[model samples]
Target: MASLSLPQVDFRAAAAEGAADARLREAVRNNTLRKQEGREARWTELPDAQALRELAARIKQHTLENLDYYLRQLVDAVRRNGGVVHFAADAEQARQIVLEIAQQTGCRRIIKSKSMATEEIELTPHLERAGLDVVETDLGEFIIQVSHDRPSHLVAPIIHKDRRSIARVFSEYFHAPYNDDPPALTQQARLFLRDKFRRSEMGITGGNFLVAQTGQVCVVENEGNARQSLTTPRVLVSLVGIEKLVPRMSDLAVMVKLLARSSTGQIMTVYTNIFGSPRQNGERDGPQEFHLILLDNGRSQILGDPEYREVLRCIRCGACLNVCPVFRSIGGHAYNSVYPGPIGALLSPLMFGLERYKDLPQATSLCGACGEACPVKIDIPRLLISLRRDMVNRRLSGKLERLIYRLWAWGLQSRFLYRVIGALQRWDLRRRADADGWIARLPKLAAGWTAQRDMPAAARRSFHNIWKDRH
Candidate 1:
């Protein structure tokens, strides 16, 4: 593996190019099975998976319904535990709040765990621009950060690349000869980041679930980067989306059980820690200061909307990405947002508005792979159809498409005209047929269709036409 310097545009372009055709479908088909089989084996090995999912679903529903009460309870609990609480209406406010804390503490270099909420706010860019050094401690995130790249996968940011690529990125960032082997690559990153961990001024992380019952923050990860990040510094900040709040500490068991099986197919992640407030006096090692910023950008909007409220049930599991045909091909960047799969598609529109994401909704084949793959089972396809309908009703669709659909409706309304048109189309195809039973290509608007596909040579007799004749 050579040093793969990941330029953002190039990375996004490669992903966008791959998703245009069959190769995108093939890529997802391959990875999806690996993840699905792994999950099935893990779940089958433990009889607790289905029960956990049902329990987790109920817990999420309960929290969502009484979110106001639970969020207030979570805040009080955190305060009781001596953790400061910050409310951010959107990303900028969240970033500003974090930066203000860092400045107030006179902190410069900060270490962080993998947190999608932090990613949603893009904490690194904000902190770096403010003259602070922020290092990602998670192995996958470390690979991406060192390469200066955006994460392609939610769980495994480097899933699109192999060990060879990992070695290359490490070699370049660490300025040492790195091996392409897995163990060697892992060792190099471990050694290089260890020093950063021990010298950090502050640490930041995202919470998996915030227990309202005990005002505890929970995180699950294969690597101990999150643990290190949360414990290494004087000021520890945990950024959690408002939707991550769960009503009770007991509910944590159910969600955690479902998390691993639905995600990487493990009975449990290698590390699961519940932190209650900052470390107390005589504690061996932990942060001296703690803060939890609960962000509610567009989440509150979803809560108010009847049609899109279920979007909150997302547990940040990447199952939808593995089973998504569109995501596999284009990866996440093509949507031009943080989220890049079925979940991303839904969130991007809501967060950024659908008008800006013109190509996203139409990118799907209307297949229900995403919904089927989801652990909580979000109805993605139905939402997509609803968005399309909304787009059309808003007159956001192209005029030509509206005309075509109207003409199609009118033609189909009269059986006599429909048969006459079908008969003419078949006659035209017969007249144009040449040697080899092929017409090579068709004309104008129809040419694009036949360019990659031979539009079923207008069967000598149409299905409806033949049915009538036989009767």
Candidate 2:
């Protein structure tokens, strides 16, 4: 099989275009703010929310440290429970593993719940290429699939789209009557998917947490579609990242509390399903064959790196994305990766390589909002800084940027040069400033920063100059 091409994202270009879409901006802004507010309200009501977050972080840290042991225990537990497990080293291997299973089982129609792992591997396209019909059951994912679009948010895939847009998509594609109301659209989608669920021969899902002790895969979702997908099909396949393992079943409470509240601001999701193995004798409804594919896909490399291992602690809550200014402005598609936002900025480059995803690390302002919003307390801004440092050390940054930074560092080290540059900057700013002391446009290298917004002129005198005079 040919290698999958990495998404070529011109972040500057995509962001410029995305910023122009008022409708998309409005939807993203409204949804993100609402989720943030809801999360804050619910988080505050919980006594010792900070302590819970800390505990969750500690548990994740401990699990990651002993990941190999936990993974072995999980695999053994799964086998003991009558479920088969497969290890995939990369996306291609993962795709092949699933394809082989589908071909062996003669599965034509497959139902999939919302799974970022499946998205990460680009499994649906691979399965479709082999002549299988795939349907996404999540309401948001279903809308995105029908519209031939990618998910714009982690939890809410269609966060960039409004109800009116969805209604149009339904009318255009499904030939359904136009209705913009939420209930009517939901009902229409539910009716359409119910048939697919019943007919699907296989089901694919992503596990939120893999329990080592009980060998169970936990999936949390607001919709019941995941439950249906897992139980309705004859064959079930779960593709989960290696980092998703937890030490035991008891740890789920801490993660559950963090995940739901952090992602959707719900005290508890509508459904939290834990599946161990296929249906045994006398058991009904579950799949006949249960397959768990533990995907590495560069995650093991991350696990080895102490600086970035905390990234694995992320519960996919999307709280960081909600608080991210860059994500809010550009949206997920502009990141040009399956994962987006602050977490994506860090993970994409780490998994895909810094050279291929060089621009991703620079996509942030290092505002630290992502770190603050993160339930597991992954220091996203710090990770971003580390990626940038790696880029600089590898000389991946452009010559001009490296040169400018070298000069900046040199200037900062020398008091005389710093004062000279500061004075020159103030003089230049004063020259360009209008009567209102606002520079609407800047020249050359600085123009991009000023293009979108005005830059305030520098003060008439430097703080150093004023301090020197007063002394």
Choose the strongest candidate by lDDT: 2
lDDT per residue (tens digit) for residues 234-272 in model 1: 899999998898887678877887788888888789999
lDDT of 2 by residue, 371-458 (tens): 9989999999988999999999999999999999999999999999999999999999989999999999999999987978999999
The parts of candidate 2 lying over 4 Å away from their true place are 1-6
Clashing pairs in 2: none
Model 2 / residue 358 / CA error / Å = 1.9
Q: Can you give the TM-score per candidate against the true fold?
A: 0.90, 0.96
What is candidate 2's TM-score against the reference? 0.96
What Cα-based lDDT does every candidate model obtain?
A: 0.80, 0.90
